[model samples]
Target: MDDATVTAPAPDEDIDLAYDVFARSCPSRHTLEHVTGRWGALTLGALSENTLRFNELRRRVDGVSEKMLSQTLHALERDGLVHREDRQTNPPRVEYRLTPLGESVAERLLSLIELIEGKMPEVLAAQHRYDGRRPA
Candidate 1:
């Protein structure tokens, strides 16, 4: 099946999509996953604040293994959400920052993060209640 010719989930109207994240076979789903995965989300959030080197990003995200961070950055870079710049100095200097599209995505993601943080008390209470009801 040609994903580019696939129709989106419009109830009453037919809309052909080049790529629909909702479609199971759509390539957009992979990009969406890359942007929203644990390490990917953290890395994007950190870079949204300032451009960073590889080590700096890993430090900012915390708890991410070196291999995981490397993989996450590569995926983000490939998705055009992260821009990597390498400067040719005596010792090579590399930096990572959000692209324009990445900035937009990060802005939305930060809003979600803020909402989650603000609702943590409620979330914790819910978790406690849920745990109390569950058998260990």
Candidate 2:
């Protein structure tokens, strides 16, 4: 594992139940935000399929600027959810893939994405109804 990569606790270790995201000081909250952020979500989803080059990821994500994509990748890397490999060649090549931990989270994220997308029509209808009832 990379020096920055965080490993999961061993099965025999005790888990901390007080590490609550709602408390605002939990470290997990920071990781949760990074994983669930707009660009992060899309980037992870794209990488879940296979390793991808920077430009390929940008294209797959759609509408993400090069700078934003870079930042998002860096954040995910720091959080140990993404693995970046650099191949030193004449033209230079870098590819991104999910680590084992990342793959686990990405699967769950994909499921959530499917659920939200499936209910989008209902969400839109609710929004319309709420908006229509408001005074002009």
**Candidate 1 structure quality by residue, lDDT tens digits, 1-116:** 44444434746777664665677777778888998899999999999999999999889999999999999999999989999999999799999999999999999999999999
Give the Å shift of residue 32 in candidate 2: 0.8
- Per-candidate clashes come to 0, 0
lDDT of each: 0.90, 0.90
Q: TM-score of model 1 relative to the true fold? A: 0.86
Which candidate leads in TM-score? 1
- Candidate 2 residue 115 C-alpha distance from true site, Å: 0.4
Model 1 pairs whose backbones collide: none
Stretches of candidate 2 above 4 Å error? 1-18
